[model samples]
Target: MREFDYQRLVIGYHGCDASVRDKVIQKGDQLQASPKRYDWLGHGIYFWEHGPARALEWAKEQKKRGKLKTPAVLGAVLHLGSCFDLLDAEYTDMLAQAYPLFVDSTKAAKKTLPNNRPLDASDKDQLLRDLDCAVVNWTIEEFEKDGTAHFHSVRGVFQEGLKVFPKSGIHRRSHIQIAVRDPACILGYFQPPSKR
Candidate 1:
């Protein structure tokens, strides 16, 4: 994991209803969205919107103007509510509070895997193990022409044992593939001063 510098973030949640949209719009800096999933009859997804570069610049500016409480980077906003239903977990508070920032950036993140399968007891163990070795830091890379940010990190763990369990009764321990991305990269669309 790597350290990033960003400023001025927009964090929000997008669900199936107007209420979800309203809450995100009210708390976030900007509201960009799309349609909900068919299953989202009354709920929405979420995402955090921000640029790492501009945010850092803003922090510097504030520091110059003596507005900062300390010469430290401002934290990110993560939406726990958005991931709750998506992850099918009743409690993500532990993960959220443990991490400095946890946000639901968009409904796009809620999409289930194409080959969805129910997790059995062995799969559950693998998931817990992978989570324990989760990535903690990230970096943001941007494409100048497209303004698209590519997030990359070196912290994710990939387990490598695909077959061993019984097909019908026992579950196979498929390796976990943790995807890493930089929260800072999301800022490219907004144009942060550091990059501009």
Candidate 2:
């Protein structure tokens, strides 16, 4: 990995329920010391600002661990009630090992929405087509309707908007802004380029 000033922190994100929140926070703090040690693909895909290369690395590691079946990456928009949800990377790392199964539990794309206003079909379809990876948003109240809802891969979804520095290789850059963020916090995951 290239040396950078980036600091790894685990921000608290609202869970499906109170118990879930408690468990997540507890895990977050534990992994704060070594956040990168965890296979972060599922959650990092959307919620993180770490860029595409890091996200792809997470996905690759997860696949190696058998945490995920496919190389495809995805993410969720967490609604952590208040914006105060950051734990140290060490805690996240600890959490990753403590609860191996929880790492992949975030498969279903979800966002922390305040209410049940469904996304327009045409607009939503267009948004999905624009992304290079699959995405799903969930809220606390409304449960996602599996069949009626769509799940798509990044190649089948977004288009390029911006470019960011690569995390590890030479002269490589990442494409950004493939889709609009509904709540601003939930930036969609990136379609990381395959190793060159």
Candidate 3:
């Protein structure tokens, strides 16, 4: 059987308020996991993989929304241990399998399945990922029930925003993101040199 552990270290950037960054880097405070139902990769501390610029952009947007006072980026060294990597066929197939189970569970509980919706009313990108988040959370819970190895992180690629060029497949905001469920997988935090 193929071990799911990725083993290699990768850098991730988290966009947040400047005060939050200061507390994490200067005071050694940990980043709290987001438990929002619409989280793209489920309840975890999320980061943009190797995309500081994009992270900063997100933070700036958040600031505009009054979520933060000043935008900043906090860099992290991460090990994607036993990750549920959506980029791979194996995991995507598993996620597809999990969808029906998730729906069944919802129906059993007399709850309706949630839908993914655009954050902005007219946007094509479904930024509010309620359905995706629910499915991922359900799949992970099922894995735990089966006594399978725990997934420390969930990683996925998102093609978002407007196309980079006319008829181009690439999106301007496309990026790979990681949601770290295991705090231990985060080796250290740093101030990205570019911004220093």
- Candidate 1 C-alpha lDDT tens digits along 1-196: 2344322223321112233233334555443322222111111112212324333443455567665533222222432211112132322343345333212221246732222122355543332222222211100111212454322221112223343555543233222121113333233222212233
Using TM-score as the measure, what is the rank order of every candidate, best first? 3, 2, 1
lDDT winner among the candidates? Answer: 3
State TM-scores per candidate.
Answer: 0.19, 0.23, 0.95
Q: TM-score of predicted model 1?
A: 0.19
Error of 2 at 26 (Å): 34
Overlapping backbone residue pairs in candidate 3 total 0
Better of 2 and 3 by lDDT: 3
What candidate 3 gets wrong by more than 4 Å, as runs, is 1-4, 194-196
Global lDDT of each candidate: 0.28, 0.28, 0.92
Give the per-residue lDDT digits (tens) of candidate 3, residues 1-196: 2344678678999999999999999999999999999999998999999999999999999999899999999999998888899999999999999899889999999998999999897779989999999999999989998998589999999999999999999999999999999888898999987654
